[model samples]
Target: MESTGGLRERKKLRTRQAISEAAIALFLEHGYDQVSVADIAAAAEVSKRTLFAYFPTKDDLVLHRIADHEIEAARVVRGRGDGEAPLDALHRHLRARLAERDPITGLCDHPQVVAFYRLVTGTPALQSAAARYVASGEEALAAALRETTPGDGRFAEVTAALAAGQILLVQRALAAANQACIARGMSADEREPDALAEADHAFGLLSGGLAPYRR
Candidate 1:
């Protein structure tokens, strides 16, 4: 029964993937607003109800990919090795993703990945949705840090915000830069050397204490 259930879950995931891919292709070919949920449902060969079951909102169809990354920061903060600071764990994770060319880093140059990013960043609604998703991630990670790091309870929220903001801002800036370079016709591979340099520079600012300037 468990195996049967597992198979059923896998089938559902595949169907979801198919629908998402079909929706993206349609959005890329036509403008996002020009396409409707009905259009994506038809294109994916799924009923409208099926698409809605997988995706709650029209914005969700495009920005659901953003959700893939939503809890990543919180997870890293929660799961850091003994004696490892939250920021250290996050930094290490990001550097590893840079080496791995993870799509979340905007460092994957595959045509489909490029198109998906172009579609997301090019569409205003998707961009707004992505921003909110990222902000939610920051908030979640801030909560994680507040709970995990031992310190004064009174200042926890303020300190967590500072820590989370510094880390997430650096990451978002690096990804945006990579996207811009790709937009200007540079392959992720072609831009990797510079991307590495940018990461180093950005993180260095945090390590050197960016918050001091604001105070």
Candidate 2:
């Protein structure tokens, strides 16, 4: 049996999912620009106030799908096993995600996932919002790196910042390539081999640059 608080949280999650699914369906059918907040509220069977409580901005209704991952890299770094290098942990994590066909890795070819990717990339507002999210992730990862890396000074901070930026850049580039392949009709299973190889090569290059900070 679940606690009352657990049940309440589950109910809230259901409501949030209902609202998000409703919003995405409408956005896909009608253009994002054409759908209004009031329209989503009606479709989700919630009051405008309820919708606003879950998502403050109209852009958030879409971006919320990825909100949980905004700090993923930071979490990965912070949670890595003792004595494991940060870059190595991150590389392992990415490989595991690719194997799992996680949509965030851009290697999942599910119809809805593909559509979601297309929707975000095609919409300027979503793109802008996503950039902000990426920047936030980068900042978070940098902070994690700074905390974990040895040395205490401006130099250590700068090194962590630079390394974080490079790691994220590589990740974005690999994901973009994977997505492009999928967009071109290659199945995720078919692309997995190439994706793994690319990830290896990209992370290998990063390892050299990040050697000084390795644990």
Candidate 3:
């Protein structure tokens, strides 16, 4: 028999996936604002209450995965190996993500993902909703810095905010580059090499300026 924790986790994952999938399908079909939580729940075969339990809000149906990344970046910084520089750890992780063309890094070529980006970019409500998701990622990075450098006076606080801002800029630049490549007729695969190169360049700039601060 499955442990209670394991069963609960699995059930939660399935419910979240159902809600996200339903929301994406609806957003892709009829635009983001036209779809409602009630519609998403009905489509997913879950009650509105069930959807809220899983997502809290309709914007979350679309922004949940994005929120996960914000938390992940902070964790990566906090968990860097002994003697490893925080920037180095971040660069390594981001490089791996770029190489894999991870969707979170904006390297996705799937029509659905592309459409989703377009939808989010174009819709005022979704754009407004995304502010918190983006801020969460920054906060996570800041928290990681605080955890990693606990006794650095104000260094960690300042550095964390700077690092988060720098990283967010890099993410946005990569997304714009990828979208431009697609607009120029490069297939997602064809665009990834350039995209990764650009990402590496962006990270390199941050790494250079912040190298002295890393411990």
Which candidate should be chosen as best, given lDDT against the real structure?
2
lDDT of each: 0.83, 0.91, 0.78
Task: Look at candidate 1 and give me any clashing residue pairs.
Answer: none
Per-residue lDDT of 153-203 in model 3, one digit per residue for the tens?
756688768877777767777777787677566777888788778877877
Q: Which ranges in model 2 have alpha carbons more than 4 Å from their true place?
A: 1-3
TM-score, ranked from best to worst: 2, 1, 3
lDDT by residue for model 2 over 36-107, one digit each (tens)?
999999999999999999999999999987888888999999999989878888999999999999988999
Could you say which candidate leads in TM-score? 2
Candidate 1 per-residue C-alpha lDDT over 1-215 given as tens digits, one digit per residue, 9 for 90 to 100: 46988999999999999999888889889989899999999989999999999998888988887787898999987898887766667777887888888989988888888888888878888877777887898899888878875667686788788878878878988998887888788987898999888887777777677332221
TM-score of 1: 0.90
Kindly give the stretch of ten consecutive residues in candidate 3 with the minimal lDDT sum: 206-215
Q: What is the TM-score of each candidate against the true structure?
A: 0.90, 0.95, 0.85
What's the candidate order when arranged by decreasing lDDT?
2, 1, 3
